[model samples]
Target: MERHCVFVTIFVLILHLVQAQNQTGFISVDCGLSPPESPYNAPQTGLTYTSDTGLINTGKTGRIAKDFEPFVDKPALTMRYFPDGIRNCYNLNVTRDTNYLIKATFVYGNYDGLNVDPNFDLYLGPNLWTTICLVKTGISIPFINVLELRPLKKNVYATQSGSLKYLFRMYVSNSSRRIRSVKMGQNHGSTQLNSTHEP
Candidate 1:
């Protein structure tokens, strides 16, 4: 075979192998959001959350008609199906030796000019969320990502078998007017499972 053709074939095979190992899924959940006493930036359709019940008739229309009106908005969906499950949904299955970037996405909008604990806490399988500080004076943090959730960061954990399993949960412990959500994502790695070195 020509040198170029041989190289091209080898590259394609490796690409497929890598892609096969990395899979992604989306897990979603639905809860509720409290309307701010004085909503200035609330979407025209008003913002609300759902409880993920199969029944979609959560009076969403009535709220939209009254608050959203012609604007035709309601609330930001906080939860959703991470597909097979929430954990490992965003990124593909994890194996030892390969590095990955797991991102957590959040959406929130609450400003009382004071410190406010989360309206709820998200449970990612056995992984515990440490905490995040939004004490930027007048800055109202309504959203966050993995990078934003920096306080309880975990980058490296070791395992002999080279695999991990996880799930996700965004439960509201206290009723707050603020709304928010969580998501996950994954990236390519330099090595494969059981390999001595990352690719």
Candidate 2:
């Protein structure tokens, strides 16, 4: 019994260590999840996501329509919609001059039952980042599904002035199997690329 207890304790400690390693320098938010339902690990990415509850004071939580839920990942099935304010912002604390990658994802699965698309602007602090214009189908307000921040290496994608906005990312490789991992830098993160080509 003593040996078994020692083994169990070691297992628990290792699990906690792994979880902490995965979350280092990463902040993931599931926009519309309720407080009790948050801090869940996404099955697709194995990333822990918390509710965007205390990040902002405005916006209301909502789930996508049942018909569209099956087509999206768990993070995209729910969203936070902002209908009252001209602009809604989420406050995050970061170290000064540290490079970071911010990612926001939106999936308009007709959450409001209006069947209409939404149009809005996204901003990074006081600067305009981009305008989100969903394809016209019906009519509704702006919504967001997931938001994430990952700290990057100091020299990766550095610019003299002003922040950088993500436009698109593409990976090219000649490997037949899916590109398992692409190392960003010496101690930076890695990305997985999927491909379906005869090679």
For every candidate in turn, the CA RMSD to the true structure comes to 17.6, 10.2
TM-score result, candidate 1: 0.24
Candidate 2 clashing pairs? 116-138, 116-139
Off by over 4 Å in 2: 1-21, 127-140, 169-199
| Model 1 misplaced regions, further than 4 Å | 22-101, 105-127, 130-137, 144-156, 159-199
Top candidate on lDDT is 2
TM per model?
Answer: 0.24, 0.66
Q: What does the lDDT read for residue 15 in candidate 1?
A: 69
Q: How far in Å is the alpha carbon of 27 misplaced in model 2?
A: 1.0
Poorest 10 consecutive residues by lDDT, candidate 2: 186-195
lDDT of 1 by residue, 1-40 (tens): 6999999999988866754542232122122333332222
lDDT of 2 by residue, 1-199 (tens): 9999999999989877765565677878899899999889887667899998988887888998998778788988889888775656777766666667877787777787776435444455432222122112223466789988888888888886545644453543333435333322211121211112222
